[model samples]
Target: MLEISRRGQAMPVSPFRKLAPYAELARQQGRIVYPLNIGQPDIETPPAALAAVRNADIRVLGYSHGAGTESYRHRLAAYYQRAGLPVVMEDIIVTTGGSEAILFALLTCLNPGDEIIIPEPFYGTYTAFSIAAGVNIVPVTARIDNGFALPPLANFERALTPRTRAILICNPSNPTGYVYRRAELESILGLCKAHSLYLISDEAYREFCYDAPYVSALELAGAEPNVVVVDTISKRYSACGARVGALVTLNKQVYVAAFRFAQMRVSPPGLGMLLAEAAAELPESYFDESKAEYQARRDLTVARLQAMPGVVCPRPGGAFYVLAHLPVDNTEAFGQWLLESFSYENQTLLLSPANGFYQTPGLGSQEVRLAYVINRTDLAAALDCLERALLAYPGRTEPPLTTTEVASAFTAPLLTQLQ
Candidate 1:
C-alpha cells in the first residue's frame, strides 16, 4: 500500500482543535458551549473596512501583485510607522495569513536540519510550521509564576547549537499573554547579533497590549538585518476571515526571498487587501474603544480565575489569553470531560489544553489556556462551568504542582505522544 511520508505522519494534531468532536457532540445534545479554546474574537470589524469591500468597484477580482498591491503595501507601511515600527513599503510581503508569513520566514531563513529556539508554552502552530519546514525546535522553559516571562537568557544560550539558525518569539505571546518589554527585546537582540542568528518576532497581538507600551522588534536600532516580523490583521482588526497578514523585514535579501515565495502563492486575497487598506485609515479612537473592551474582558477573566479554588492564573500584561494551572492531573482528560460529561446551567466551557503549547513533554499537563474573546456575560458563565468542572472532575489532584516541581519537570525528556 502507498503510505504517507514520515513528515506527514509526524505532524502533531492541534490540541486547540483536537477535541472538536466532543464539542460538536455537546452542541448536538442541545448544550451551549462557551468556547475559550481558540482566539476568535467577538469584536466587530471596523465599519470602514467592511464598507470598502462592500463598495469595491472592481470590474474583475484579479490577483494582486505578488508582494501585494502597491497601494495596500504603502498604506500598511504607514500603519506600521504610526504604530511605532519603522516600516516601509519595500519591507512588506502580503501573506494569506500570519500562518503563511511564519512558514515563509522559517523556509526562507533556515534549511532542512536547521534549528530554531522558541519559548515553551508558545503558539502550537509554531511547532507545525517548523515540522513542515523540516526544521527542528529547541525550547526553553518559562515560568508561570512570573506570567510566563521570557526564559532566562542563559536558558536560550544553553539551547543553542551549531545548527541553530534563528530564534522565534511571540511578543504578547499567544498562550501566555506575556508581553516582552524593551529590555527583554534588547537582550534577545544581543544574542542574535552575537551569534549571527535571525530573529523571527511574531507580533500578531501588538495592538492588544493592556498594561505596557509595546516595543516592536522593528524598533530595535541597528538590528534591521536580524529582525523579521510576522504580523496580521486577524487579531488586530478582529477580521480573522480576511486572512490577510504580512512578513516584514528591513533586510533586502530576506524581503526579496520572501517575495519570491509569495509569488508561488500567486497573491494574497484581493478583497482582504482592500479591507486592510481601509482598516489602516481608521481613526485612533477605533483602537481606543476596542482596547477598552478587551481590557475589561481580560480583567474579568483574571479576577474570576483567581477566585477559583486550586487555580493559579497570573495576570497577563497583554493579549486576551491567560494560562491557568489547574488541580487536575491531566488537562486533556479534564477538557474532554468538560465537553462530554460536565455542565453548569446546561452550559459547558471548551478550553485549549495547555500541554500542546509546550515542546517539552509533561510540562503543561495540569494547565489550560483560556481566551477572553467572548463578552463578560458569557465569560462569567464559562468561569462558572470551569469552577464546577474542577470540583467534580474525577482526575482532580490536591496540592497543585509547586514552582519547584514545575521547574524540575521542564527538564524531563520530550514525550512521543502528541498530547
Candidate 2:
C-alpha cells in the first residue's frame, strides 16, 4: 500500500461539505431540501457579465499573466477604489477564487507551525487552509449570546504567542452574519499593530451587509502595510463559478511574496477574468436589489426562527447566514435528523452544524448555521420545519421545549467532523 503524506493526515476535512451525503439522502427520499447549508446565492448574475464572456471572440484560449489579465486587474482595482479601498492594478493578484487568495496569503505570510488568530465560529474553510499550510489556528471564542461580535481585545491578547503571524477575519462573517463595527475593527487594528501582526481581511461578503456599515482593515490607512484584503466575485456578483478573486495589499513585501505564490498556480480562470471585469462595472443598483432581497429573507427567517420552540437566532447585520442555537443536545445529530427524518409540508432543510466553526473543542455544540439563500416563502417554510422539529425531535436536555430555546443552556458541539 502506498503511504500518504503526513500533511494530508494533518489536515481536517472541510466541515461544510460533510452535509453532501445527507443532502443526497434527502434527495433520494424525494424530499425538497431547503438549502440553508451553503453560502451559494440564488441571485441572478448580471446580463452584461454573461454577455462579455459569450461575446469574446477568441480563436485560442491562452493563459494570461500569473497575476491575472491586465485588463481585469485594472477593473478590479477600480472596483476597490469605488468601494473605498485605495489600490493600484499592481496591488491586485487575481486568484482562482477567494479560496485560493486565502491559500496564497497563508503560504506567503506564514511559516510552518506559525499561528493565525481567528474568531470562533468563523468560516469553516479557514481550518482546512490553516492545516494545509502547516499553520497553527488560534481560535478565540465569540459567544452566540453577543450575536457573535468580535471578542474583547484582551481575549485576543491572551492568545498571542511569538509564533503568531496574522489575524484573519471575514467581514459580515459567515455562519454568524455578524458585521464588526468600526470601533471593534479599530480595536483589532490596534492589537495587530501592537503585536506587529499581519491582518488578512476576507471580504467575500462585502456587499451583503444588511444593518451596519462595514469597516475595512484597509480603511485604517496606517495599517495598510500590515493589512491584506482578499476579495472575490463569488458573492459580490453571485458569480461563484467564475472563480475570480484577488489578493490585494499595499504592503510591498507581502505583495512580492504573494506574487511568487500566484506564479505557481499560473493564470487564474481565463474566461472568469472576462466576466469579472464586466461584473465590476455593474450598476450600483445591482447590489441595492440584492441587498433588499437578502434583507427580506433575513427578516422572514429571523421572525420565523424566533417563534420556534427551543431556538434562539440572532438577526444578522449582513450576509445571508444566521447562527441559531438550537435546543438540541448535539447539533450534528440534530442536523442529521433534520436531513434524514424531519420535515414540514413534506419539505426538509439542510444546515451546517456550528461545531466545525470553532477551533476549540466542545464549543458551538447546539448551534447550526442557516443560510437564507432561498426566497421568503421557502425561508418561512424552513423555519416552520425547525420549529416543528424542535418540538418533535428528542435531543434536548429538557423534556418540554421553551418558546425559543433558552440562550443560556445551549452548549457547543463536542466534535468537528470531516466532510
Best by lDDT: 1
lDDT of 1: 0.90
Q: CA lDDT, every prediction?
A: 0.90, 0.85
The CA lDDT at 57 in model 1 is: 98
Q: TM-score for candidate 1, please give it.
A: 0.94
**How well does each candidate superpose onto the true structure, as a TM-score?**
0.94, 0.94
Task: Report the C-alpha lDDT of model 2 over 1-419, residue by residue, as the tens digit.
Answer: 89888878867666676777988888898888888888888889888999999999999999999999999989888887887878899999999999999999999989999999999889998988888899999989888788989998899999999999899989989878999988888888888888899999999898888777777888884878789888899989889999989899999999999999898978899999999999888877778989998888888878777766667888899889999988889988988988887876678888888898888999988889888888776767676667667766777655865645433223323122111
User: Could you give candidate 1's per-residue lDDT for residues 168-208 as a string of tens digits?
Assistant: 99999999999999999999999999999999999999998
Model 2 TM? 0.94
